[model samples]
Target: MWVCLVVSVALIVARLALRKVRGQKITHGDYWCLCAAVSIVGRLLANHFLLIYGSTRILSAERRIELLKPGFEVQASEIITGSKLVLATRSLLICVLWSLKMAVLDLLARLIMKMPYERKLLYVFWTALFLTYLASIIPVFVGCHPFKKNWQIHPYPGDCVIGNVWLFTYEVSNILTDILLMAVPFSLILSVRIPGMQRLRLLFLFSIGIFLIAVSIMRIVQGHNSRVQSAHTLWASLEILFAVIVAVTPTLYALVRNRHENTTYDKSHLSMGATARTHPGSLAEGDRYAARVWTELNDSASRTDTTSIEGILVERRYETSDVKL
Candidate 1:
């Protein structure tokens, strides 16, 4: 869990560095990612204390009674503390996952900003995600009656301690939001006219969400098949870590490709300069003409807004009617 937290922090830092290198302004998505990093740290600390307090151990009703006997006051106290930590962990886990979801939505909103219809669809996705998040968290607080039963030891309701209802609610809501979030990118990809290779790369990057859904299913299955609480934490941590990685990958790809293209252009420019210096008659004229055409193309591209993955991949067409060779 600590390792996952550290790696997530590192990825966010790398994302910031890439933005600085590319001379791009920070967007809402970067702020959301920062929020997720803080939540990940909190979840790790909660998990640590939860283990120390011995709250993660599954206990039967008879075992609860045995532990609550007169001789085990310290053990009972530890169990109560652990139960509260369990609650904290659940809240932080939700914060971490949903922050990443918001970050992705922010990027998607920028991608389709020009299309009013697509922008409306993005708003619907935002509303769906928010509603599902509420559905997932409401049960955590209200699933157990009397509120104090959430941390009570002996004779407490099963829903308070076992949380089967909350778990099932969270799993369904989580999977539903993930599917809705992925649909935006897939729809944009289908509607755009990108090169085949670029389209394939975009598809693969967005398809990482499928792994997140699979992980959610595995968490549910593990929770049912095993009596251990640690297994759930393990899967939750993996899901959060993978979400952060997926959110930053597209921007990182753009940064690397931009640098490569710059390097190639610089090398070619130098080669043309050397050739013009050696043969100054016709080659010099050709070099000057090439520079003018390059300037015009750059000016045209600058006029178009290419801030998102789809924008970056879509081919730009330039008219050459005004350029005299």
Candidate 2:
């Protein structure tokens, strides 16, 4: 996750710096991605701590806990560690997931910001997501009858029935949200009359959200496996990590597209130079023009200003949703 975070931060910084040079307003989407990077770092640290403490449970009660009987034993330390891991996982997962969704969604918002109806729909989407995030997190803090029931060991005054139902519901919601986010961008793209290659790239980028849905399903299937808490934490981190990868892909693609455009421009200029050299009277003039052209190209290519490099990305012909703002 942190790897993803670092790459994203680097890209966004490059993007913002380029935009600044071009005198373009740095969009909210850039800030959203930055926030997502920070959230990824937070999740990584929390999960790292979780893995260290949770892995301590690898020892059976005999070694790690006080053995009181052949069938049953108790360890206060293990219980405390278990409680911390559970609470940490429960609380932090939502934050990581929410940040990931917001990052992806905000990018879409920037892409389609000029479309009034769609932008309003995004407002609705953000509100619903915020509400869902709250709903999902509130229960972890307040669901238990006495609150301590959340981490209480076995031998409750009565039977201690663990709630697998909520777990399944949470997984389903995660899958549903991933699907929703994936659909929005693709649905909008479908209406645009872009060239086939650009359309394919857009589809590919948005389709990455499917991986998040797959990870959510796997997480549900792996529920409550006590044998390896570290494995569980690893898999959970991957859900957000997968999103980080998808979120960074489009920005990186812009850089690639910019390079391709530069190559094309240089080739065209070289062809013009060759044509000029073909005429005897124009040879000297052509040589000077070509020299000047080469100098300009070299200067522009050497510039690290991200916006001018990626200007074509902002002006892609298929941005039917574009507004002046």
Candidate 3:
């Protein structure tokens, strides 16, 4: 969990740096990423408390009875504290995961803003996401009766510790939203005419969300099969770690591609000049052809920018050729 937290923080920092280097304004998506970071920190702290107090859910029936016996007041208090931390950890985990969903949605909305149909589809997605988010959260608060029992150490209902209904609802909603979010970008990518490599990169970037779904399912299975709260927390942390990585990957790829293109442009400019000087006879014809190709590529790139990934992925490049003399 600590390793996941550290890597998540580093990725968030790198995301900000990448935007600065690219001269791109920080968008709503970036704000969402920051929000996720804060939630992740809170979750980590809650996990720490759980560690110190030790989750009540992990205690066996005999162990719990032993702790509740007279003269075990200190142990009882610790169990109560860990039980509360369990709730806190679950809440923070939800916050971090949903914040990431919003981040990706925000970016995808911007990328496809000009398409009226896609925009409508995005609205549908947004509505579904909100509804599912509520579904996932409501159980956290209402799943247990006499809410205080949520932290009650003994003589509390099983639902107070781990609500099966909450687990089922949250997992289903989580996976549903992930699939919906991934579909939007994927459909857009398929409808457009991007280079094969660029298309592949975009597909791969969005495809990483599949792992989030897998992690969510695993969390549910672990929760049902194991009595250990720490195991559940571990799976939750892994989900968040993968979410952060997926959120930052597109921007990182854009930054690297931009640098490589700039270098290639400079080298190509120098080579073009050398070609004109060495083959003076074909200079004018070659110049005209090169100029036309450059204009076309630039025009196509500009048009693609409106719908491309952060306006950084679908650039059309000119392939320089030797002048015929």
Candidate 1 Cα deviation (angstroms), residue 31: 0.4
Per-residue C-alpha lDDT of model 2 across residues 66-154, encoded as one tens digit per residue: 43345533354445566556666666677767776776776666545433355577877788677777767766665556766655544
Worst 10 residues of 3 by lDDT: 290-299
Q: How many backbone clashes does candidate 1 have?
A: 0
TM-score of each: 0.77, 0.64, 0.78
Model 3 TM-score relative to the real fold: 0.78
Cα-based lDDT at residue 91, candidate 1: 85
Instruction: Write the candidate numbers in order of decreasing TM-score.
Output: 3, 1, 2
Tell me the spans in candidate 1 whose CA falls farther than 4 Å from its real position.
Answer: 61-63, 259-325
lDDT: worst 10-residue window of model 1: 291-300
Query: Model 3, 1-325: lDDT tens per residue?
Result: 8998879978988887876786666767788899999989888998988887886667777887788789999988987888788788778877887888888887676554333244577879789888988998888888778888777667645745676777788889989988888876776667555577766766887799888888888888887746676677788779889989877776566565553333432333344332332322133433332210010011224232232212332211123453221
Candidate 1 lDDT, 1-325, residue by residue in tens? 7787788878888887876786666768888988988888888988887877766236677778888788988888888888888888888888888898888887676554433254568769878888888988888788678877777776745655677777778888888888887886787666555457656777887888888888888878776645476777788788887888777776566555564323432333343321222221222333332220011001112222222111242321123233332
Model 3 ranges with Cα > 4 A deviation: 259-325
- The lDDT for every candidate, in the order shown, is 0.67, 0.54, 0.68
**In angstroms, what RMSD does candidate 3 have relative to the true structure?**
10.3
Supply every candidate's count of residue pairs whose N, Cα or C atoms clash at under 3 angstroms.
Answer: 0, 1, 0
RMSD of 2: 11.6
